[model samples]
Target: MRPLEVWLYGAGLVLSFVAIVSLTRSIVVTIAKRKIVEERKAVQQEVQKKNEELVKQSALVESEYFVEREAREKLGLGREGESVVLLSPSATEPGIAAPVPEAVQETKSNFRLWWELFF
Candidate 1:
């Protein structure tokens, strides 16, 4: 009878430990799944926001004003009766070569450069 009682108690203890472990794992999995759902929701919201911005940009691109502005700025097109005056580059164009002023065109030898650096 004593041996039987000890066996039953040991079985009960093992069963209780298994139950606790299973419950803890289930709770952890539930929490992880909830966190995943929340992350998915946040990503979905960000995607929706990006979609809305793209829609707005698409609308702007489709508008006549944007087309006209892009044409005027990019293609150098002018409206009817609006004469496009061509202006020469005002020292800002990269292609235009200007002579460097003599004062700024000084070339120093290596020795002179070293002397200047030290002194």
Candidate 2:
């Protein structure tokens, strides 16, 4: 074969090899960028959910019922002629029950009551 033909063939092979490497590199980069985008979307969704939960709790805290309940329970306070009563733990026995206290009779939200029991 002529020297020029051999050199031309070698150059063509090298250029094709370079093209293939560049294509594979770009594909890898594109896949990595897609994964990063998905992760960011997941994180944004989580943040949005947490923000909604905070708004719900803020509304609850602002309610009159929550304020009155907190004042009565935490501060041991009442309106005029509304006496607070205390009872012994033994009086609360289920088998031979005594009168349930006023504070205990005041119903709590199921979630709040469960949270208090568990946490």
Candidate 3:
């Protein structure tokens, strides 16, 4: 009778140990999955923000104002018969300094400027 009772107690102990280990493993997997989901959400938000910025940039690029601005800045172009006055960097300061004047021909194209710069 004593031996039979000992066997029953040992079996019970082993079963409880298995149950605890299985529960712990399940908890660990749940935590890992939660972390992965959070990371995925963060990445998605960043991608959405980048997409919004690209949309805004594309819209700006397609606008007529953007084309005019680019032409004027890069090609040194202006409205017909309008004199484009250029001021030297030093002239903008508050100090009194006589700024030398240099005139660019209105007919000179951007290609001519590039040619002069390189050759």
Candidate 4:
């Protein structure tokens, strides 16, 4: 073969090899990016599910708290006026004073203050 023809064929082979290498690299990068995207989607789905579960649990806790508060306020079921007789451990021991109930006037005063502030 002539020298010019040989040189042209060698140049064509080098260009083809370079193109193959570049295409292979591009394909590998695309596949890696796809995998990363899928993994991120899975993690996001799990987080969304966990958030929904936590919201449900919070709502249940709030309902229970409301029920207990309603029972306490509306039923007046707490030991309101029952008297307790204390027995002394020993006759020589000093006797403790009876417990005194605090006045409910503070709650009324606070309620009036809040109403005045808001109105």
TM-scores, all models, native as reference: 0.65, 0.63, 0.60, 0.52
lDDT of each: 0.92, 0.92, 0.91, 0.81
Per-residue error (Å), model 1, residue 51: 1.6
Clashes of each: 0, 0, 0, 0
Best candidate, TM-score = 1
Candidate number with greatest lDDT: 1
Worst 10 residues of 4 by lDDT: 83-92
Candidate 1 lDDT over residue span 64-108, tens digit each: 999999999889999999988765575667878765567666789
Tens digit per residue, CA lDDT, model 3, 1-119: 69989999999999999999999999999999999999999999999999999999999999999988887888878878988777667777887697556786478899998999999
lDDT, ranked from best to worst: 1, 2, 3, 4
Worst 10 residues of 3 by lDDT: 98-107
Off by over 4 Å in 4: 64-119
Evaluate candidate 3 by giving its C-alpha RMSD to the native, one decimal. Answer: 8.9
| lDDT of candidate 2 over 1-119, digit per residue (tens) | 89999999999999999999999999999999999999999999999999999999999999998998898888888878999986578777768777565865677899999999999
